[model samples]
Every structure is written in C-alpha cells, then in structure tokens.
Target: MKTANNRLDIAIKKLYTAFHDDCLHPECCKQCAVGNILDHSDAWKHFSDDHGSTKLNYIGHVNETFGKRFNGYTPSELLLIEVTFLKACGYQLPLHFKNNKPENPTNKDNLFKGLQAVIELLCELDKSPNVMDYTKLFDNLRISKKSLVLK
Candidate 1:
C-alpha cells in the first residue's frame, strides 16, 4: 500500500510532466488533474457523471463505502481535488463547454494555477506542508539570531 506522501510525490511528478507537455485539460479525463494523478486513467470519471462535480455517483459511493483509495485519495477527495483544480483554472463547475472555462485551457499559466491548487489539496490530504509553498522559506523564525546581529 502506498503512503499518502508517496502518492503525493507521484502526483506532483505526473502533473509536472502533463503540464510541461501541454497535455493537461479540464475536459479530457486522461489529461485532467485526477486523471494525471491516476496515471492517465479515465477510471476516475466513473466517480461522477460531470467532470468537476463533487457529488459522487453510485460507483463512487460504493468505492467510498469500501474505503477504496485510488493512489491514496478517496473517491470523494478525488472529486474535491478535481473541482478545486477546475475552479482554480477559472472553470465553472461540472466542466460543460457552455460553462465558463479558461480562455485558453492549455495555457501554461492557467494549468499551473490549477496544478498549484491540486498540489495544495494533495498536501492537505497527506497532512503535510505544501512542497510548492516557498513562503515558509522567508519565515523570520528560520533566520538565525546571529544573522540578525550585524557586526
């Protein structure tokens, strides 16, 4: 069984590859955030009829009931993660073309924003700090007292 951290690492790598390759998309199951995390598997689509819907379908509920985790994320968590990604990418929920979507879905900036949100969610799921967060590097507490005392 893979630990949450292991899953997070794998997810980050996959997302990085997808983003760099311009393969990430809000509409494509194999290219969406959850899809990439699941290694380009469309199996996650069975969790919900709508792409960005948080409400799971029968299969999702069944899997949730069985405590089945795909790459260390529950079915509901997967839906939430996808929804978060879609929202961050400026997409309207459920991902219908009629709904609002980024002007350029494949734009690197939009995909990066989506990936950032997804990574943060993944970190939350793993109960770990967001590896992408660099603000902590500027924390005053981490500075040495000696460094504060100028010669």
Candidate 2:
C-alpha cells in the first residue's frame, strides 16, 4: 500500500504536471519549472521547530496550555484538506480506482465553474454559523468565521 506521503506526492505531482502541460513528462521533479509542493500550513508553522521564529511552539505552549487555535492537524489531515479543496474547485485529483477509470479531467471552464461554486458556497455559509463549523482550514484560506462551530 502507498503511504500518506506517497499519496500526497502523487497528487502534487499530478497538479504540477497537468498545469505545465507535462502530461507525458512521466515523472515529477523539484526543478519542474512550473510548480512545487511544500509544507506551509498553520499546522506546520505551529509545530515544526525548523520554522524558527515562526514556529508557535504549539505543543508546549498552545495546545498544552490554552488549547488555542493551534490544533496541530496531522499530515494526513492537511493532505485531505488540500485534495478536497482541489476537488471542490473542480480539479481532477489523481486518484486510482479499483475497477473503473477515473473521470472528469480538469479544464479552464470547469475550473472557473468550480471556483465560482466554491465562492458561492462559502458566501452562503458565511451567513450561517452552523455550516462554517465543519471547515477547520477556513482561516488559512482567509475566510472569516464569526463564531466557532459548537458541534
């Protein structure tokens, strides 16, 4: 079975490959001349000591003390958020099916449509407190939430 990092690498590679018209590139590389994936999330900023001044020291300070916004989402959770955002925006995620071939290759029109839908959905959710609670990464996306989801 593929590990989480492997799955993430695959997804990122596809995103990088497709946009650069490297459909037949056959592999992903750091010097792809288009895009590269890296960890830059709140969870990473709040946890890793490598971030130096930016690190929130979330474990020793935030969650261990007041349980502030530093919830320290796992790598898998981050991957889920990334993949979901891409899908919600109509990007074709490079997921392999057990039987049937995957459908819905992303195109410019579909991407625009998906983005429009996402914006409308967020706007609608903005008026409703209950709906926004399920989404934890909204702050990262610069979305404003008036209150926490109590459920």
Candidate 3:
C-alpha cells in the first residue's frame, strides 16, 4: 500500500514525465538541455492550496519562444507511441469515453485506462481536500513492471 507521501511522489514523477518529455520538435535537444519541468495546467493552484505539489492534472512544458518545429512523428503516430509506452510502463488505460472511444478497445485498453486513471486521480485530488491518501485507490490499480508479459 502506498502511503499518501508515496502516492504524492508517484504523481510528481508522472506529472514530470508528461510535462517534460514531450517535445513538439522531437529533435529539440536545446529544450532537453534546459531539463526544466514547468506546470502547464491549472492544477498547480489546487495543489498549492492543499500544500502538496503532487496534485498534477495536466502538465507539459510548452515553449512558444521557438518558431515552427518538426517532430518526425504525426499526431496519430504520437498517440500510438504514447499508448504503447504507457502500457509497457504498467499503467491502466481506458478504452471508452463516448464519442472518442477507440474501436478496438481491447488492443490498448490498459494503456488508455492507465492514463485516464492518472488524470482522474489528479482531478480527484485536485477537487477533494481529503484525497491525499490514495493507497486504497491505487494499490490494486497500478501494475508492477515485473508482471508485464512481453508479447
């Protein structure tokens, strides 16, 4: 069971990845060189209110200073890659969400579910003051990488 502190730590790490890893210009080693993770979402205010910096909802490092950029991957390709990466990382993902749900949900349901779970958890944490302890909520939910089956 993850204590509130541990869950907070986990959330911070995920938020860091989501915020810092995306480079519209995949070749933008300059931004990577900066190695800074900035908050790109409104969740930071909520986190500050709770006196916890781990309640991350939507985080990303978007730099408008750079002009047009080229990332070798198309939008669809980026989504696929993100889905695969998250799955390989052991996060549950959702497959259904009304109009935007995937047709082949089973193919990467876990990945979607995992991503959704993270966002949802962050949202819940943002909204609820007592949601600091997420042990019961995330214990059985998050999978260990060791349990992943390489197929």
lDDT tens per residue, model 1, 55-133: 9999999999999999888999999989999999999887886887778888888888999999888888889888888
The residue pairs that clash in candidate 2, if any, are: none
lDDT of 1: 0.87
Tens digits of per-residue lDDT for model 2, 1-151: 1223443334334443444553311112221111122322233333434211223354535453564321233433323333343455443444333322214434445444433333333333233222224356666554343433432
Clashes of each: 0, 0, 10
Better of 1 and 3 by lDDT: 1
The C-alpha lDDT values of all candidates are 0.87, 0.34, 0.32
Q: Where does candidate 1 stray beyond 4 Å?
A: 1-4, 140-149
In model 3, how large is the Cα lDDT of residue 53?
A: 19
For model 3, residues 22-94, the per-residue Cα lDDT tens digits are 4311112121101111223222222112211122222211211222112322222223333333443343442
Work out how many backbone clashes candidate 2 has.
Answer: 0
Candidate ranking under lDDT, highest first, comes to: 1, 2, 3
Give candidates' CA RMSD values in order: 3.0, 16.3, 17.5
Candidate 3 collision pairs: 19-60, 92-113, 92-114, 93-110, 93-111, 93-112, 93-113, 93-114, 94-112, 94-113
Candidate number that wins on lDDT, 1 or 2: 1
- How far does residue 109 in candidate 3 sit from its true spot (Å)? 22
